[model samples]
Target: GDDSFDEGSVSESESESEGGQAEEEKEEAEEALKEKEKPKEEEKEKPKDAAGLECKPRPLHKTCSLFMRNIAPNISRAEIISVSGDIGLRGRVGVNPRSFRFFRRGWVTFDRSVNIKEICWNLQNIRLRECELSPGVNRDLTRRVRNINGITQHKQIVRNDIKLAAKLIHTLDDRTQLWASEPGTPPVPTSLPSQNPILKNITDYLIEEVSAEEEELLGSSGGPPPEEPPKEGNPAEINVERDEKLIKVLDKLLLYLRIVHSLDYYNTCEYPNEDEMPNRCGIIHVRGPMPPNRISHGEVLEWQKTFEEKLTPLLSVRESLSEEEAQKMGRKDPEQEVEKFVTSNTQELGKDKWLCPLSGKKFKGPEFVRKHIFNKHAEKIEEVKKEVAFFNNFLTDAKRPALPEIKPAQPPGPAQILPPGLTPGLPYPHQTPQGLMPYGQPRPPILGYGAGAVRPAVPTGGPPYPHAPYGAGRGNYDAFRGQGGYPGKPRNRMVRGDPRAIVEYRDLDAPDDVDFF
Candidate 1:
């Protein structure tokens, strides 16, 4: 009985333990289900919280940032942001940082998807106090902003050292004349002295060696030693100095050409190429061929003549001025003497009545005459002068006596007539006798009858029609009589007062006596 009771107790304990374990598993499943649902519930509430926090509704489409311009000077970036925020805009607002006084432009980037056109439309007519704001989309603003950042953050400065070096090299090349000849050719000495003293000195210094005594003297005196001077006699340094002197000479020559002779060096001569053969001056050496742009020898001579002509008058005037100054000082006033340099003509002529050669009209002054000529007859003045000179020469020639004319003696003979059958043929068939019809008048057709039938010619005083003047035609008798003296009918129908009959008859069947009027 004790063992059975113990077994019953064990069975009861096992059942109780199984029931407790199942209840604990059910609670854990319920807790896990609640925990899983909590996340979904929080997720659902999260959107609502976000919506409540947002100050403005989100847009449905992508928004474009805009570059606003023409903003009032008094408006600040914060005010712009506030104004945009009032219009439900949520975006970063940036004003041009470069603006110090008047903030006339800015950029706006939206945080949410919003239609750019709609934002612009709503922002239209936005005014800060009394100042209006202009807003529009500038697609290039992004690129400009990038550029501005780069400029502010990564600035760089470049130097043209290579260009300067190349220029220096070219300058040196222009001055150094390389005199090279064939392998077996003999060297010829040039007789012309060097034009540049600096170049001549450099060449002499390079060729002549320095003595030890001179070197010591220069070193003790703190002056440039002769041996050290040879260091500066490097070909590169010598070439540079020579080029500088040559450039100075060239500039002076060009200035003289322009100021004194009114000649353009570039226009007269082709620019020298560094590659061309060097110019040689000697009895045996010949000059290089003339460049394409070089002025001809004749043109150079003419220019020289004109230059001399212009210079003569100015020199004379300068000499006269100097002499006057000298006389005023009661001695030769060297310091007061006028320099004999010729400058450009800038002297205005006296205001005097000037006549136009073309129109023969008088002008108030030379200026007015010049203006009139330039405006009216500039193109034709040269042609007109040539024509006038030609006519004058022609008139002079016309005044001379004419030479007598010699006439050839005519052969005495009777006038030759063309044979009747040998007369020249007409281009077209002749419809009438040559002299019968006048030019431009149509020829009358000949009336054809039996052969040898003759048509009598009407008398000059007769009417044209045979039955005229008998009845209805009687009215025309007076007109015909007035035109041809009198009308006579055909021989077949004669009438009274007919010139063909040479008689006049009264109307016998009419009234016998005339009544007094």
Candidate 2:
């Protein structure tokens, strides 16, 4: 399928590729199959079986091609991985075109929905056992875990939930042995060193864990975990915390394994220095043993080219979130929402407050019906004053009995005389009394001719300020030009260039050539 055209995604061409197309095809087939199953067929096709044959469309247990007439669209290749124990693809072959649903010679659906992660995870780390629990889930979570101060400090969010399988095989689970998948045989032609490092670590880690469990059962120094009163920090919790750490290691280990399997060393050449670069990549120092050799630069570059061709498809998956899943996940989760808010051009204008129904107090968020039990209505600063005036006028118009008005009493009349022995203080004035004549600005007539007749000074023409904006200078560089302080002698305008200056003058008694017309 052409990965470029997403079902509900962007319109970019050549977007989705092979495996991705498979997933799209899956959705298409399912949709079509569903529509085809609608049973409103004519009763004529087969002398309607006495009891109508349930004319339901039979499901094709097999896969089909959704390849368009010209070419497929919106598909990315699917990852093919090896598994341990049972049900995974059984051959030494890689995934992508070879797997079952994707096996269609023509078309295939390659969606993020297909259970490759699960398949990949189980294949990488399987503990075959007879119990009912699935144990290979640790397969995919090798990377993508929280690492704080190199610590798994908090609960990692689970996705596509393998928690059941994780919980089932947990060290404490009694039913583990029943279904532990056997970590299959190491394949032939020498286990690639780069890929095997994590496998080696996992092998060692699992062995140690298994050994520790056994010793706890037998040794006097160690025994079954004791039940103690829960405290601020519990050992059991700490142990689980430690498991989270180990889980993180496992995740990294899985990624390392995939890298080893998917990549081919380049710098070392076609026949790599097996000792120097056994696999395409490895954790620097942690990568296994090394052997030295020399190869040509051209050979090294060619190797790089070959390696990238194989690895780009693989790295692309890890590098970018599959378009569909990124959109979908980003939509549903708040982190994605926050991420969008931070990274995308989503900007909020401002906050708005509304009155709370229960308390009648102002709040922010979604709006609520206004409620008022007490006389006051919770409102914004602007709206509060309006509400007060509104309520006051409303009561007055309602003809409701109002409180008495409070006003100052007037003074007694002259005929009434002094009712009491007390005299009144200074009386209030109807207007302000005039003060001494206001001072006027100092006279400017002394400097020139009178009130507003002063004229600007005559042409003592010069740079106004030595340090004025733009170019100004102190001393005169030329007879009439100011020293501009530019790199050389200043860039001053000569007197001749000054527009205000009279360049030439003629006298009435001068020679004919110089005389005025």
Candidate 3:
């Protein structure tokens, strides 16, 4: 019975111990569940003071540290501070201490309160001088910290401005003028119109807010630069002070404007009209009074007609004189005419039995007939030559002279047609070879004569015989005195024989033997 009772007590104690172990395990599970749910509740209850007015976690953005590239290597920490202030970050956020790095790269750390999205947007438009900045976020700032010097300085500046405003208000009177100054102080006017007339329409919000207390402020940063008056305005009116000398100069210049305009239009028959002047010629208009004594178009036409009438008589005289000169100069040379007649007619007339037309001599052949006409009939040949020259006027209209049928001169034989002491091979002495001597020059000495010796000449009852040198016996070598002279020089009289002394005085009716009357 004792053994049974001892085993029952031990079994009962084991059951109790087992029940206690199960209860402890259930309590441990409930405590672990409560501990896990505590962190979730804390996460749900975000602090409002973390990101300004908006409730946010401690780490507001994905990153506060920014990788700044394209930073100038020479940029100073103070300059970086000033630049951050310029980005308008002082009031809303803060920056880490010593955020600037070296070289072309740097770092910028903002406080947890900074709106990274907004800062990135503003950074895109910001340039470091001309170098654009490329800012990359490193990581979110999880710490609650504010290490910035720019925000503190900005706050100090705001406090000082407020203090200055209060001090300025304390000294003003009811009229908003300086009432504490001595008797000579200038009264500050309540309202003053702007001195510039152009800005009369524009508002002058900027006033000269000067006071004796604010003199130090004015000296440190001087008043705004004086506004430059507008130099451009309507040209038609004088809105500013005008100089009398300049006005007179302009008036004088306008007075001479018409003279320049008239010179441009002078002698231009086809001028552009007013409508086309601006676009075609670049001339707009003449700015002056109308010119006096302007001739009408009809008067101009009448003047032109009268001018043509006066010119017509001169033109007719010119034409008549030209024809007379052409006819005179066009006369065939006398020797050429004689040669033509001899070559054409002499050969034909003396073909069957040669005959000399000039001397009426007869010969056995045409060669003797030609020699007879050239030597024995030399004087008669001159008359025939003169007839040829005179008849040239009739043949002027014919393209060629009416030449008879040509027959060659008689065949050569043991015969010569030349004068005495001349060879058949020698050139004819009477005919001057063409191009042998220039006009206006003395003829070269004949083959038998000395270089300076003069040759004696005999005329064939005509002026300056064609066989002689021009002006052969004239005392002076004047090229103008003979028939063979140039057309430009005098040829009215013949020059022959020995030189004669001029008769100083003479009467038209004097006897031929008398030297003077």
Candidate 4:
């Protein structure tokens, strides 16, 4: 079926075919995605410029030497600063041309190897002050970028872009400030949020809500499993029941996929750009040349069977009459009408199975199955929601204990206290407690316990549990507490007036069975 599906998907593949230039795009991308798997012997390809000129592949450094070098030169230092500042505030990368083809100009090549699109995507709502510089500089930069390939470069690249972008943007920002400072006025500089991600976290809450709803739905109606892992046996099945289960899962998965497919359409703008099919893999591993192609009729039909299963459980799936009906009506595969039926009046899990705690139906996808469980099992899910909400509330109200207000630690007692003036953080020779000392070794405490305490026998060579000898140096413990002194109170855990934060421990009463997504 996968083979047949491959054949059917071929014609549709071209638009999806990494575009017409996919083969060309990756020849460039692979040079970037050189994992260790690539033979170490393979010579690294030289980078080129738009005019076929050998732009010395000087290290691609800073956040964006490429943008600054190509686009902002003609612009004033002040304006450049402002643009750089805006983008820096906006984030490391910003624009997204329709295709990876835009990277060749060297303004920015599509380093499929460099997945900056995620950063750019995250920056969509990222706001910045408009650069005072004229629009022509921006236009020039665009022209230069347009001259070469860009999008095709992305394949396996990730995080380094974030670090490099942050660093370069800061450098440019500082430079801009020095150049723009008024004759007598002092320059004010801004620093990045110590927190690497300046943006607020919103995904966890979204995912939580989605999971909860799916669980509720699944319990009410027997629905798909949360995950459809790879089945580990023969493809065509011998057991009819097992085959039916697999079919059910595939059907539900198709429904879920339909939602995803619709969301993927660019017109909807719901899909993340880099997530567009092959944008990542094609740019990374499948580079160099297209493998001519693969297609065949038998393969196509086998896949059609799979597609039928997927369509069967959908509420909005397409359909047509059966082959028998179609033939009667002068048509082929009239049974295609079944596609429409697949989506119509689907089974009701909620009305029939409200008594069960978990839905038994499953799909060939983990996500859909999980979604079903969360959406259909509301009562059971409430327990987990309450806990998460409690945790969330704690985060909101619990202040992080203040560092500056933390009081110096109280002098430690016995076992290993370092002598008073010992500077912190140095290791000291260990001196075990008297009772723990090797046989025959005896040390006396300098001072006796409490005035009224009984005079217990000393531990020099006494029996186990006997009081330590009078001269034993008990309070002089050390903690990597540098050279002969006590550590500076091992950094206080809690401080006073300094906006103190609290950390509440879990209540024993809380439920532990709630599944995490």
Clashes of each: 1, 50, 1, 98
Writing each residue's lDDT as its tens digit, candidate 1 over 1-517 gives 9999999999999999999999999999999999999998987878766767776764444435766776766778789889888776766776654443545567676744667778777787878878777788645223211111111111010011112222222233233433334458754344433333323332322232448897787779997845454543323221111223333434444443333333333233222221111111101111122233323335444544543444332223111224344345344222222111101111233456666655677766666766676567655545545555554443343222345569798764454333354323211222221122222322112222221343223333222222223332233323222322222332222122333323346564656442211
In order, candidate lDDTs are 0.43, 0.32, 0.44, 0.34
TM-score of 2: 0.15
- Residues 1-517, candidate 4, lDDT per residue (tens digit)? 9999888888678567567588778876786677653654343453334326555554433222223222222333344335445444322322333322332111222233343444344334433343222121112122211111121112211121122223332333343343345678764445423221322231221121247777778878886666846544554421211133322322332222224232211111223333322221111111122123333334444544543444322222223334454445443222333322222313335523322225557454444544565567545456555555544433333231224447688766574544675323321224323333333332222133232333223423233333334543334432212233222221122222233333334445655533222
> By TM-score, how accurate is candidate 1?
0.18
Model 4 clash tally?
A: 98
Evaluated at residue 25, the lDDT of candidate 4 is 82
How displaced is residue 149 in candidate 1, in Å? 22
- The candidate that wins on lDDT is 3
| Winner of 1 and 3 under lDDT | 3
Runs off by more than 4 Å, candidate 2? 1-195, 201-203, 207-227, 230-240, 260-517
- What C-alpha lDDT, on a 0 to 100 scale, does residue 143 get in candidate 4? 24
lDDT over C-alpha atoms for residue 8 of model 1? 100
> In model 2, how large is the Cα lDDT of residue 108?
23
Model 3 spans > 4 angstroms off = 1-331, 344-352, 384-517
Per-residue alpha-carbon lDDT of candidate 3 for residues 1-517, written as tens digits (9 for 90 to 100) = 8999999999999999999999999999999999999988886786755445565434423225456655665555566557666665432222222222434555565655777667766777676566766776655334322232221122222232223222222222221233334569764453543232222322221122447666666657876334535535543322222234333333333222212222111121122231211111222222232223323345434534553444332223121224455467565667877777676545444447766665566677777767777787678678877786556645453323345669788865543344576434333556542222333333333333342344333333222223545545343244333334232222212223534422346566865445431
RMSD of 2: 36.2
Residue 367 local lDDT, model 4:
44
Which candidate ranks first by TM-score, i.e. highest? 1
